[model samples]
Target chain A: MTSQLEALRRELDRINEEILKWLNRRAEVVQEIGRLKLKQGINRFDPVREREMLDHLVRINTGPFDDQTIRALFKQIFAASLKLQQKQHEDALLV
Target chain B: MTSQLEALRRELDRINEEILKWLNRRAEVVQEIGRLKLKQGINRFDPVREREMLDHLVRINTGPFDDQTIRALFKQIFAASLKLQQKQHEDALLV
Candidate 1:
């Protein structure tokens, strides 16, 4: 029983590690997009694109997490990513 | 110009999909752990374990995300997963 918990925890930890790496990768891509947008004088936050992405993710979701939960979690990540972009843009302006 | 944005958006979309899948996989593991806890009559939330996980994630993080942001995002995921577990446990009792 204890060993079962150990094994499950290990798997959970592994999954969390993968997620951390992927989230960082996603942030890197967002950073690149932000740089491009700044160069083009385009706004960084694209609500239409975000809505479409969320919709697609919700549609494809098969879960122990319901669609709403999936939407909420991803939305937090998206919001954070946007914040990071805005901070970068601000820092660039100050330079 | 447009092509570059398009390419970046595609990569972002792909990474989002991957993250979505990984989140679900993580949820599945959480469910297993939940079941084990339920069987053992143990409390569902483990603050010490959670603290450990977050600390390890923070230490390993190399990011466009600051450690606080990493903690916040994972905490949200962890909270949601705990809710999922509780809901399952309640449903089990109803059966």
Candidate 2:
């Protein structure tokens, strides 16, 4: 039982590390998207695009998490991504 | 230029899908952790453990997103995971 618990803990740690890597990868891609949007004179916050992404996740989620939970988590991600872009733009303006 | 934009969009989509998968995998592992905790009569929320995880990410992060942004994103993920565990426990109680 202790070994089972230890194995699960290790799995959790492994999954956590993978999630962190993917999240950082996603952030970098979002940064590229932000740069393109800026160059095109488009705003970073696109409600339509955000909605579509959320809908796609909802459709694909086969979960230990329900759709509401999935939506909420991704919304947090989207919010942070927008903040990152906005912060970058603000810094650029000051430069 | 249009092709470049399309390629970036495709990359974003692929990365989003990967992040979603890892996030869900993280959720499942968290669920298992919650189960074991319950079996051991332990609580789900462990601030020290969470802090350790965050510190690990911070130490390793090579970021397009800053540490603050990374922390905020992971905090949201952690919050949602806890909510999932609590909801599941509540549902079990009601059943």
Candidate 3:
């Protein structure tokens, strides 16, 4: 059981690194979008797009997780990306 | 520019799926850990361990995101996993 636990923890550590990599990748895309939107004078927040993304995720979800929990987690991720983009935008303006 | 935006959005979609997979993987590990802790009469929360994880992440973090933001993101991930484990524990109790 201890060995099993150790293996699981090792897997968790690997997953954490994968998550960090994906998050940074996502952030890079989000920042690019932010820049494009600014250039086009488009709105920063798009509720319709966000909703569509969530709905797509729900349709694709084959869970050990329910749809609601999936939505919640994705929303948190979305919010983080949004926050990162916003911060970048602010910094750009300040410069 | 529009093509670039579309490409970026596609990349974001791919990253989103990767994040979902990792999050689920992390959740499974957390659940197993929760079970082990319960069986061993160990405490559910471990502040020192959590701090060590965060500190390790900080030491390894590479740019575009500061230590604070990385810590915030990891903490959010940790909280979600904890909530998942608690719910599983509750359900196990009811059974």
Candidate 4:
């Protein structure tokens, strides 16, 4: 029983680590998108793209959480990516 | 050594769960703030409050990541919470 519990705990740890790794990768890609938006002089907040991404995630999601929650999570993610890009822009100006 | 590792892993998992619970609580407050803003006819984006939160988070952060990263993370979180509030507003309007 102890060993079984150990195995399950390890599995959860592995999954959590994988989730964080994927989140980092997602942040990197979003940063790239922010750079593209900056280069094109487009608004950081793109409702159309955001809506599409949320819709896609909602359609594909089958999980412990609901679609709205997932969409809300992603929306926060995009906002954070945009802020990072903006910070980079400010740093470049200061330099 | 395996037992020690198991203990550490369980600790991290517990921390992760606590973090998620706190996030939910934060979202609830943000929702309340959103409704108040609507009632008083205020903007959703409050630069002063946001800047203050980020600054506080950065000041309090002590970790593997830098202050900027911490601030960036919180900014994303606030954005997500705001999005949830906005969605709630829209739902109310639709009904």
Candidate 5:
């Protein structure tokens, strides 16, 4: 039998891969949003929508991780996506 | 034709679901690690390993998100996981 730590590590590796895939998918959506926002002359950041999302996540969290940490993680995700969107917009401007 | 924003929002919704799934999976693994650590009398927090992970992430990141933000996000993840492990250990001790 595999050691418990080894098994757990394997699971973590699998989940990390899945997270990477989802992050990339999210980035693609952010790029699309950036394009649309540029066309509409809209700001990329939407604090109200982000707050709504965090609230939703808080409601649904049945966690080993607490609310504050969950919020922090989601905020990082949002910040990363926003940065990705901004980069896409800048690249489009240059092209 | 679907408005670009609406289509992008749909994609974001799909990706968010995937990300949520992966996060939960990661949490499960973290709990397992907690159990193993408790049994082995090992500390849950491993700063060196975490640093190695952040370094790997930095090397692999091709991002609009800078290295500092990536490291920060990973630190949050590590902290959350460490907390989860501690909680598990406490619960098991009480059982």
Candidate 6:
């Protein structure tokens, strides 16, 4: 019983670490996109691209959660990413 | 010792429930705002309002985490809310 609990604990820890790593990776990508947008004088908020991304997520969703739930999750992820991009842009202006 | 652990467990559980409830509240407000935005034909992505929210968050931040991290988390929450708005709009359109 102790071994089983330890194994589950270790699995949860591993998953938590992976989530952190992925979030870090996501911020990095957002920063790159920020640079590109700045260079191109493009708006950070691309409605068409966002709509397309949501549609793709729905198409690929093999869910334990429903489509609306997945869409909500992805939307939150994108919003965070947009903020990262905005922050990077502000930092560039300050420099 | 067991009692202390149990108390801590209950506190965490209560925190979890509150977080979920707050999220639901956020979603409800987002829906109301969505209706307003749709009526006005305003873009859902309002940079000025978002910037104000982020600035207010930063001002109030007495942090265990840094400003950027907190901003990122809030940004994710905002993005999720936008997705909910989009879904609701689509449903209205279909009906």
Better of 2 and 6 by TM-score: 2
TM-score of each: 0.97, 0.88, 0.87, 0.50, 0.81, 0.50
Which 10 consecutive positions of candidate 4 chain A have the poorest summed lDDT? A12-21
Off by over 4 Å in 6: A1-95
Which prediction has the highest DockQ against the true structure?
1
DockQ of each: 0.92, 0.72, 0.57, 0.03, 0.55, 0.02
Q: What does candidate 3's lDDT look like per residue over A1-95, in tens digits?
A: 37877787787877887877777778778988999988888788888888988898888777656678889878877887898889988988999
Tens digit per residue, CA lDDT, model 5, B2-94: 476777776776676667666766887888887777778787777886787678767776654566766776677777777777777888989
Question: Which has the higher lDDT value, candidate number 1 or candidate number 2?
Answer: 1
- lDDT per residue (tens digit) for residues B1-95 in model 3: 48877887788777778887777778888988999888887778878878877887778777456678778888888887888888888888899
DockQ of 5: 0.55
Binned by DockQ into CAPRI classes (incorrect, acceptable, medium, high), candidate 5 is medium
The local distance difference test score of each candidate is: 0.94, 0.81, 0.81, 0.55, 0.74, 0.59
Q: How do the residues A23-60 of candidate 1 rate in per-residue lDDT, one tens digit apiece?
A: 99999999999999999999778899999999999999
Best of the two (1, 2) by DockQ: 1
- The global Cα lDDT (0 to 1) of model 1 is 0.94
Residue A3 in model 6: lDDT:
50
Local accuracy of candidate 5 as per-residue lDDT tens digits, A15-89: 765666567667767877877788888877889878977887777776656678778888889988887777787
Q: After superposition, how far is residue B27 of candidate 2 from its true place, in Å?
A: 1.5
Clash pairs of candidate 3? none
Using lDDT as the measure, name the better of candidate 3 and candidate 4: 3
* Candidate 4 segments whose C-alpha is farther than 4 A from its true place: A1-95
Lowest summed lDDT across 10 adjacent residues in model 2 chain A is found at A1-10
Please count the clashing residue pairs in each candidate, in the order shown. 0, 0, 0, 0, 0, 1
Cα lDDT for residue A77, model 6? 59
Query: What is the TM-score of each candidate's chain B when compared with the real chain B?
Result: 0.96, 0.95, 0.91, 0.87, 0.90, 0.88
Extract clashing residue pairs from model 2: none
